[model samples]
Target: MPHYFDTAHRQEIETLRQRWTARTEWPTWLLLIGVYAGWFGLVLASDRLGLWWSTVLLIPLVVLWLSVQHELLHGHPTRWLRLNKMLGYAPFAVWYPYTLYRDSHLQHHRDEDLTIPGRDPESRYLTAERWRGSSLWVRGLHWLNKTVIGRFLLGAPLALAALANEERLKMTAGDRHAWRMWLTHGALTLLMLTFIARYSVLPVWHYLLLISVPALSIAMIRSYYEHRPRAAPEQRSVLNEAAWPWRWLFLNLNFHLVHHDLPGLAWYDLPHAYQARREQWLARSGGFLVQGYGQLWRRNGIKAIDSPRHPFH
Candidate 1:
């Protein structure tokens, strides 16, 4: 693989290193407060509004909350790790524990392992042996999952089931971290559900079906084509100069290569860093660029990007 940056660019990058302060980040705190207000406001108002209307308002907020949690996992908007974890402590997404997410995401920063199936926790590809051994129905589902349409529709539920099964195996094998994470997640989930049942107009089941499921679906649109298997690790991740709405919603995460390169960089500063060396970064990624998610939908809306099989396996 070719070099990603020259001497001049390296100096440019050096100047952008984050400056840590003793104070909290007010912008991030305000965002966190505003997001929670909107989410709960919608929940409380669900009784007066239409069911679909509530879902429409709540889904994006839920997705944004998860995005905020992703930033928190990176120890952003704050210098203290405990405080960051506290802010993201709630299990409103109702899927994974924050601790588990933090651990897995940090591990995913190993750029060399990006999109290597089992090696990368975030990878969506399947092993060749697993694909060949799958039943025809299972194979068909995998094919459908590769597309944007099927991904959001079926991806969340299937992924949740797979995660649960994986957690079960880990617990069975006496993984204490897995056990603690799941226990914490379960307790938080129960508390959240109880609150919803007692105070919110939306029932717990309805909240899960409406807010949680669709939030996962919205997230799938971003992750669907974020990475692909390649010999050169730099080329694995994509750079999507998507619209402002997406950039805001995903917190500038569309610049996957930038985040992978600078895992500790604050989310708000990604665009500046990317723009500073737009040409070089594009070259670094071997031109793995997408105009937007719309382009991805148009190209892979009907056909799959690659077969489910991980050729190496």
Candidate 2:
């Protein structure tokens, strides 16, 4: 990471961004619309298709949809700003607002923006003070989130509530964009709930639990190895740990180095482009971490408190 902050390396990053981000406007728009519609349709169809296929198949589809949204948010698969946000912010995850994500993400790109617990919305890592002050039960719950059981069963709602609290803050403060985002998301949420309430055989809460838990599980995987401040500039992102099924599910975003290198590279192109620049990136990161989430956990895991200076603390 310290090695990566050097001037000679930054030119490489700037070059990659300039060359890859330029694209045909129309195709980008078409791809954006198509992806959003396809995923949203899959959500509705999951109900009709019954629990078996929905969980086994559609859940991954939802993850891919989320991955596509990630790309769009970075200005990909389209040139039009509003259209891209519409696609990414559709609330398919049913909890997070896209605008909020966009805001926090830009902050994340700041040079000194390592993990800051209270200030950084997307930060799962804790500040030093938070780590010290947390009760035994709360610490246990946070640990639970990293493991498979906690991630799938308990982590989803916990994460959602945190996200919704942000929405509530934005709403109370009258942030117009946040207001619009929630309005759109709220209407969709209501429609989804109402349909389940009136006609579905399963309890409405059950349907929500079934779909949302698995969907958020994918989010858990996407973020699993993505951040670490100790490593510094180059090794900032945690490399992907999941293989095969989970890898494709998150659209190869697991390749953390390639992502940081060419932030504008499309999903399909990331792996290839990364492979080309692998050596340079690896050297740059000071080989901070090359393993996946499992390896990370095996090492007693990492936390936001790992940093010398955590804003939350």
Candidate 3:
């Protein structure tokens, strides 16, 4: 793959990395502490807050936790992958195992394969063959998945079902690693649900349906059109100039091209890095940019942004 930064830019980024190393990532550490503290604090206070209020408050924390997990998997706040895994392994989001996500996401960083179905594990597109084979209703769901409202309504369930089916196939094929991860995820998820059942006013079912699921739905917003298939690898990922609230919720991943260019760059530094070479970055992306999520909703709310079938396939 071609390097995004030239020699000078790379050296400048190295200087920033050195500075970060010198001070340590205190901000990320604070984020780790604050997100966990807020989530637990809200859970504990759910009875006083009432179900609706608590669910509303808790969803953002859960979404932030997902962002934190993304940071952890990328070696944020610390260099130790094991320690990061230890911090992130809790089934707080209540669906994916940390290791499962880590492995798939790292594969997704292979820019050459971005948005290629079967090659990119995180791809939203379907293979042409699969698209052709699907029933009309199944095809309708894929079309819906391309729309903003459809993504919020069906994204989490569709993604969860696909992941679950993949893991089931792996387990059936005697994949012990898959088995272990799922078992561990099951135990951790059960523990979390048990705690909510015992201590929180929100019912466990309600927590799953209202809080965790919706959090996943919201997180999916960042990725709804984060990548597209382009002939050039660098042109594939998007540069979404999302609003501050969206940026904070996704932890600067709104700068998707920047993150793709510098997978090891800390979340806090992404915006500055992108701003430093804004034009060059934009050029590299072949001008694949959006003003904000609001633009996406206004233009593609009910309309499919692009065909669900992979263009290359």
Report the number of the highest-lDDT candidate. 3
Error of 3 at 35 (Å): 1.0
Error of 1 at 93 (Å): 0.9
Pairs clashing in candidate 2? 241-292
How far residue 127's Cα lies from its native spot in candidate 1, in Å, is: 1.7
Task: Give Cα-based local distance difference scores for all models.
Answer: 0.83, 0.62, 0.91
Candidate 3: residue 284 lDDT (0-100) = 86
Model 3 spans with C-alpha error above 4 angstroms: 1-4, 20-23
The residue-level lDDT of candidate 2 at 306 comes to: 38
Q: TM-scores, in order shown?
A: 0.92, 0.76, 0.97
Question: How badly does each model clash, as a count of residue pairs?
Answer: 0, 1, 0
- Cα TM-score of candidate 1: 0.92
Which pairs clash in the backbone of model 3?
Answer: none
Model 3 C-alpha lDDT per residue in residues 1-313, reported as the tens digit of each score: 2364679898777777778543599889999999888988998998899999998899998999999999999998789999999999978799889999999999999988999999899999999899989999999999999999999999999999998898889999999999898898899899999999999998999988888999999998889999998899889999999999999999999899889888988988898888988999899899999999999999999999999999985
Give one digit per residue, the lDDT tens place, for model 1 in 72-91: 98877776899989889887
Q: After superposition, how far is residue 78 of candidate 1 from its true place, in Å?
A: 2.1
Which digits, one per residue and each the tens of the lDDT, describe model 2 over residues 12-56? 544544553344434345555766666555546756867566556
